[model samples]
Target: MTNPTLALTLGDVAGIGPEITAKALLAHPELREIARPVVIGDADAMRRGMRATGFDTDALVVIEDPREARNDPDTVELVQTGPSLADVPIGELSAAAGDGAYRFVVEACSLVRAGRADAIVTAPLNKAAMHAGGHDFAGHTELLAHEFGVKDYSLVLSAGDLYVFHLTTHVSLRRAIEDVTVERTTQVLNLAHGLARALGRPEERIAVAGLNPHAGENRLFGDEDADVLTPAIEAARERGIPVDGPIPADALFPAAMRRGRWNLLVACYHDQGHAPFKSVYGDDGVNITVGLPAVRVSVDHGTAFDIAGTGQANEASMVLSCVRAAELAPGWGAVVDALS
Candidate 1:
């Protein structure tokens, strides 16, 4: 009975991905107590990260196979996955960096699918760089969905007691509004509930945000929030989901996040949730994908290319993301399996 292993994938090599991944494992020794962590990225790039970030390269032990990874707090296990990114420059986008980042994700997912790893905590990958590399996906979620063969999934941003689930992400605002439906709303609520339960919080207070100004103001501003979102919340409450509102988008976040009125808030679209969440939580925000059987968590920010090699990048998000993934991974499979 071994502890579940976590495949920690490095994001964009040319960015701050390698540095943050290294710092997360090094700074947080508690991570070793929960799971066997193995770095899934380019070895050369990691060595460069250590040099740039003033980390002890000797502490990063390169292993030829994932099975060789150990739960040793003193050393970080490295299992190289992608092609060499030696030519890729820091603080800039490169097609080679994109390809490496994409490869690390695919390899990490493969490890989980093969049962070699139990969960994955990914660093940020540059979307434009990956597209230039010919991966041709919008973001990590799309690629994960394609690899895992899942159609129903949601992205959750969590920090402290506040949690937000996006009804639509990585899409245009026009398309995002159209994508919101009764089915998607109900599905995301269940997923958010499952995530809270997996973290041992079963009370699961749920809040639904309005799509219009002040929740349509009784259809004065718009009707979609009342016509579309209200029905979904009503149905959920009838099913005993502990749900409430079509609250005003502006007021809902303040009440839920700052006032502690709710545990989860379902946003109508991307920026509506992300803007406030990131503003308040800053570098502490963590993105958790709830529909997959395996726990998947990631830093809420993107590749900070401008500060990539300056050692100025904050690894707080990375540290929190890994900590949450390890805490949730043990029972995540069972929770998701039961939901399925």
Candidate 2:
């Protein structure tokens, strides 16, 4: 079989997306062995990133089609997407940046849907910039969900042995609370369990974090944990998933990460997972969205507007994302089927 081709989307033009992606494609020399990577972004933006990141422009091979790409580490294959971003300001948010990032994602998605690419490994996009560009969706997850026409997806982040799936991400705290319904909770747990199996870990030890302090202290803090989270965990167990919790948020993650007690941990909200995950894993992390028609692994970091054009951005996370994408692509169909 041919190597799985990955459509790598360059995120917002104003951030380190292009710069880091350019650097990452070069940093991992074994990437070409794992999969063929075709960059999906503006040619000019990529050139700017190459210059800023100190990669020779000759490393980039501009291609109009995925079939034109060759599996060669010596060249960075690119399929330019979006409007001309040659004059767009770097290190600052702009509508052009937002629209440009969205264009790259759409093109990559189209390629994968058409069977031209096997998977997508995205760099970060700014939600504000995307909104300003008028293509408003919460973030990549929501946008991908909409494009794929499925609501049964979940955003999962992995670092070393720990995996976190958010129950409510990118919403107001009030809305986040309202979103922690038994149905959503059960669905997310199911998604998380499916994700573990998809990643080749059949021994899935899943943990659910409580929404309230001390897990509502048995009704002292709040009732969401007992009222919503508990039933979901019970239902998942009934479904034959190895699951446990509504454990106190404070005690749960530390023990899991340090003690290696669980393979998957479901968080109540965005920061509940992201905050501690970033703190411990930092640049060695990857974000995976499970239950999509195609496989997607992405850098867990955001658009670094501060270090956009400085050639100072680290590509470690992007490298990890690509590595994970390559590892998962071959088995992704089984995952989509399991989640679907």
Candidate 3:
């Protein structure tokens, strides 16, 4: 099989997306060997970022086809998605930057749908700027699901060795609690299993975290653990899925991540999973959208508006995003086979 073409969408130009992306491409030596990396953003912005981040390259190779990308150490191929943004200032939000970011994602999706690219890795985008520019989406996960018409989807975050999927994301705390149901939990568990399989762990085990403190303290606080969670676990087990839970959130993380335990954790809400995952992985985590028709992974962090254009943002998360994208591609087995 040919090398999988991984298309990267520069998040928000005004933020650190371009800078960190260029840095990741330059620092990772093995990445250029496994998959043909292609950037779907403004060429000029990428060049500016390369210069700003002090990443020296041989030349800017433009390509019309993903198969034409040269898998050389000094060569980085780019497919221009939007017009030149040479005049757009850094560190300030503008409609042009928002439009450019949106166009990059749409173009990447087109490439993936057309079979030109195997998977997509995205940088961070500012929600406020995107809304102001008429994009009107909460985040990348929602946008991708809408574009592909995928109904069963979950946001899975990988921090170090810990993988977590939330029952609800990008909503208020009260709304997230209210949204918890047996059906939703089961759907998330199934998605988690699929994601684990894609990551080369087909028989991965999953543990579900409870909603309330002490797992509702035996229904003294709330009945969510017994009513919603216990039934979901039982239903999944009936289907032959290896799942265990309604475990207390406090004890779940340590037990799952201890040594040889479960491969994934399904959190009842957002913070219950994220807080522990981020604590271990720091900026090395990647947020992947599971159950989509196409492969899409993103940096777990958001646009650092305060430090925009400062060249201080770390690219570890973006680098991990690329690695995860390569792993999910259909031709990923070739890359892994060659490495092994």
Best candidate, lDDT: 2
lDDT of 2 by residue, 122-142 (tens): 999999999999997999999
Model 1 spans with C-alpha error above 4 angstroms = 196-203
Flag the better candidate by lDDT, 2 or 3.
2
Q: What would the per-residue lDDT of candidate 1 be over residues 1-340, giving only the tens digit for each residue?
A: 3566888898899889888877778877887776788999988888888777788888889887678886678777888885678789998978898898889888989989988888898989999999999999889888887788887788889887677998999999999889888888888877777666766776778889999899999999988887788888888778767777889988999888778888788998989999989888888889987787678889999998988987777888988887787777877866686457
lDDT of predicted model 3:
0.79
lDDT of each: 0.84, 0.87, 0.79
Can you write out model 3's per-residue Cα lDDT over 1-340, one digit (the tens) per residue?
Answer: 4557888898788888888887888767688767778888887878777777776644567777766777665756788886898777788888888888888888888898898888889988877777777897777888888887777888888765567888998788899989999889988887776665656675778988889998898899899999999998999889877887888888888777655366588987778888877886678788977767767889988778777666788888888888777766764443234222
Q: How far is 306's C-alpha from truth in model 1 (Å)? A: 0.5
User: To one decimal, what is the Cα RMSD in angstroms of model 3 from the true structure?
Assistant: 3.8
Better of 1 and 3 by lDDT: 1
How many clashes in candidate 1? 0
- Give per-model TM-scores: 0.94, 0.97, 0.89
